[model samples]
Target chain A: MKSTLIIVALLLMLGGCKSTGGPTLYQQLDGKAGIERLIDSFINQIARDEKIIHYFEDANITHFRDGFINHLCALTDGPCEYIGDDMVAIHTGMNINETDFNHVVELLINAMNELNINHTVQNKVLAKMAPLRAEIIEI
Target chain B: MSMLKFFLGFIACLLPFSNFAGQGKLLATPGVSQVEGSAGGGLVPWAQLAGYATDDEFAINGFCSRADVSDYTLDVCGAQINLFNRVEFSYAEQHFDVPALNTKIEQSITGAKIRLYGDIVYSQWPQLSLGVQHKSLRDGAVATLVGAEKTSGTDIYLAASKLHLGALAGYNWFWNMTTRYSEANQLGLLGYGGANSRQKLLFEGSTAIFLSRDIAVGIEYRQKSNNLGLGEEDWRDVFVAWMPNKYVSVTAAWLDLGSIAGADDQTGWYLSVTGYW
Candidate 1:
């Protein structure tokens, strides 16, 4: 009976010590404004990366930036709705290969690193983006 | 010596003298090469492919490994290719030396692995693969003297692997489990089966914690069958691997091979160097 009580007490203590108020990804990325800046920097990196620049030659920079920011904000649980086209619809017939996709991911990681984003947050963001490879690569 | 010259030439060929341009795939995902020529931890095989190849690409890798124990020494050299991130074909040659017995054992292994389902990364489910290895021993007379049933055998295995990114305080965690059916003794160095001539099912498991993008530390446990009643026990190891770049990786481990051929508590150090493209 005493051991059971001790276990119950320990559980309560553990629960009490648990961190429930840690900053969310949205706040860690500094909300919509910071997301906008990240997208801007990411676009610049993509524009300069020769391996991926050709894919964006015909893209509309302003529209792509807006859509990307909104998508990123929504993905990070910010107060925004992604109004862009679905991944499959947007990438169909683009002939984007795995090499291109990985290059873009690398550029994004570089952008995040330049912005001093924490590694954990960077991985979380990348994990969210990784699933889109099915719809975007050679689809 | 010729062996040392070969080793040096291998390293020179794998050296990152010039960057190969336009390579895709994530870093360190394919993992370092195992002694058996598969992509995995130091001693055990994982379900991952052998190189930095994605679904639409192919890659090739080569490695050499050496293990020094209290009673014996082992050297392995092998190569493998990953096709479209799905299938892997490998070949390895192993040399075992027992100084006390003034004898040497040599074996050649051909292996193949096919990915069945899931992804190592970017998926909730673990990646699973099926593998087969055919081993042939060079010294048939020595094998028979050791009470082996055959000088050649096959091992079939199913392995599952998963990586949990940022699961532990911003660090990645890797897990793998393999089930194997085999009749080989001492991984086919002493040859197939034994006096009992029975194939047995065994289990192997590995878990790792990633310290960074390029470094990981892990532990492995492998169960073995004692068909000959030679007091062969299970194997275990603690290992650390470093992939400084996509082209090169190195692993070091402390391994326990239990008792082998009357040698008890056979503990050792294992080192391997790998190159991938």
Candidate 2:
């Protein structure tokens, strides 16, 4: 009975090992479905944020949502390609200031909180997105 | 403490009028006011300016701190103004009580700082800043008795700070390093320069890990110049800070000041509160 129990524990451990080999950041964000939900939440947050709503008044929500999903998916190593316009190209004429940019980040964080995303995962996502500030701001 | 109350009351009065105030930076990014009224940990000043003002905004802040050791008690209260997130100006009054001497020492510090480069979180490099503090001793009798040369002095410092996301076991890691040149003894409370009449370059450092969005635990080390040679040892502290939001922050620390005025093993507890506008 002891040998059988040990074998059973070994099998369970082996099963866990298969999933732990390397879960990409994309998988940690719960893959495509999770990304969609996050984008939807972000949209709702932006829609209500009066401080930055003006900047998006002319935006095509469907296109922006699709592009953001793809961008985040590719950035996090998901099985997707973001072939849309580069960050600089898309943000050049917007002339977003530092405060507005930071406000957007705050709104995104709030959206993630509403989704019950863990802090560690949220931090990872922000880290991946932070580098885009240079390409998106003051243009 | 009446002055401290007045400052807190002043901040409270401004709260209703500050609809656009504190909306620029992320919450808890400005840090709490240090002992000397600069934005930093309890003992060391950081590169970030005080308050949550961005390039297009301005903010004001008030803070009070108390430190109680085995032999003495130090009380400080101050106010700060941040302009466009670029410059900071501060004024603080300090009172130190010594029951053994049955007397109190008083001093005031005026400080100004300017940001030179980068941002704490968004930039590729650490933020850099330059600061200056002018200190004046209100009670100079003790300084004269201790063989100090002057009752006033100026300190100049350069500081750099950065925050790394998910760097410490999935928590945010923040760090600051500062170098100062000064001749102040016990931060000018005991006066400036004693046996050593010249200013010395000193190093200070602070590091913290954000356990969550609203809390940070940290440590700080400040190298002191023993101009008085009264066994004026270095200062170090371990601290925990709680910022429920941008409106207020409270910090508590365990301080090890080593030695001061010929006394040794001066360990203590410190508590501080900062209110934002």
Candidate 3:
């Protein structure tokens, strides 16, 4: 009976490790708290990218942070609606470059990692925000 | 014919990269390699005078200019552009003089920047690119290599960039190092290939700091090895750029370039303009 119980436990662990792809991503990151936690971590990292922190000198520190969260929440099919400045208007004079943009993207991915979000879930989120490049960078 | 075909094949590989990597924002600069930054929706460098990459991968940009050197003599300028992203293709030429000196020279540079990794428009951060530049002067004696003659010099660099804030704000940053050799021992005749093709490595960087609806400021720094096969030199600059709307952009800057070759350091102001449609 002991061996039988051990075998059952092993099988359950194996099942848990299986790749359920999309369903697993949804299960891991679908909730509101999960989304909020992810956004919180992302902003914290951006604040720390010392090389670029100076650009935000004029940004409404707290407001920008919450605005980004709301912007993201609405993007991932969440209930929040983004009520921030239009992309072009907000970034009018900022001379953004690829390195800055990619670095921020990396911080975001790291944020997801801290939240224990899976790769598939992360990719899904990136895909939704990828098109925003047009609005974010000044060409 | 074989060489031509080989060259064509080489060019085909570098196309679409311009589609995703072009700075659509920045313009050509005399300083460090430009970082990967976005120009909102276009594929152009922010500070460069011409676009390295267009919406398509394959593209060519050319320009000619004439500057008054102080008297009856006029200087003619020419630069070539060819690109596709992964691999780079470029040509630059210059021939100007102080007619009173009865002397003139010319130079040219050919180089490439490769695409390594990262998202083209991920938004959260800038685009990333790593590549090498092999620039050199053409076949000309020191006294005759006037204006914009080709240079026989090479440099390597790493670049990362992005676009931000839409029309309200944006910035592009990059770092690079260049090596210059003295020709026949003349310091002013250094940029183009000089004396047995000396090799000097430099550290350079530039940033286009934007603020407001259509105004921007830029800062640049370039450090170089001053060896006719010898040592090093240093230089730095500050600039202000204007983009009244989205179609036209202009930049004027002040420079501090201790010296080059045997020529006295030509530190002064520079102006550049661009119209995008």
Candidate with top DockQ is 1
In terms of TM-score, the best-performing candidate is: 2
Provide fnat values for all models in the order shown: 0.41, 0.59, 0.07
> Residue-wise lDDT of candidate 3 within B197-261, one digit each (tens)?
44444434444434432455655555444334332345555666666643345555665555444
Query: Candidate 3 docking: what grade?
Result: incorrect
Per-chain TM-score (chain B), model 2: 0.94
Measured by lDDT, the strongest candidate is 2
Off by over 4 Å in 1: A1-20, B1-22, B196-199
Cα-based lDDT for every prediction: 0.80, 0.87, 0.45
> lDDT tens digits, residues B1-277, model 1?
2433454455456446324421476777787777677777877788987988777777777789998989999999887777778898887888899899898898888789999998887666999999998888878777788888899998898999988766555567677888999888888887778876554999887777778778988788787888677888888888999988888999999999999877899999999998886
lDDT of 1 by residue, A9-118 (tens): 45334435423578767888888878887898899898888878887888899988988998998887788788897888888889897767877888998899889888
Off by over 4 Å in 3: A1-139, B1-60, B63-88, B96-100, B119-126, B130-139, B143-151, B162-188, B191-199, B229-232, B244-248, B261-265, B275-277
Of candidates 3 and 2, the better by TM-score: 2
Error of 2 at A49 (Å): 1.5
lDDT of 3 at B89: 43
lDDT tens digits by residue: candidate 2, B95-142: 999999999999888899999999999999999999999988887999
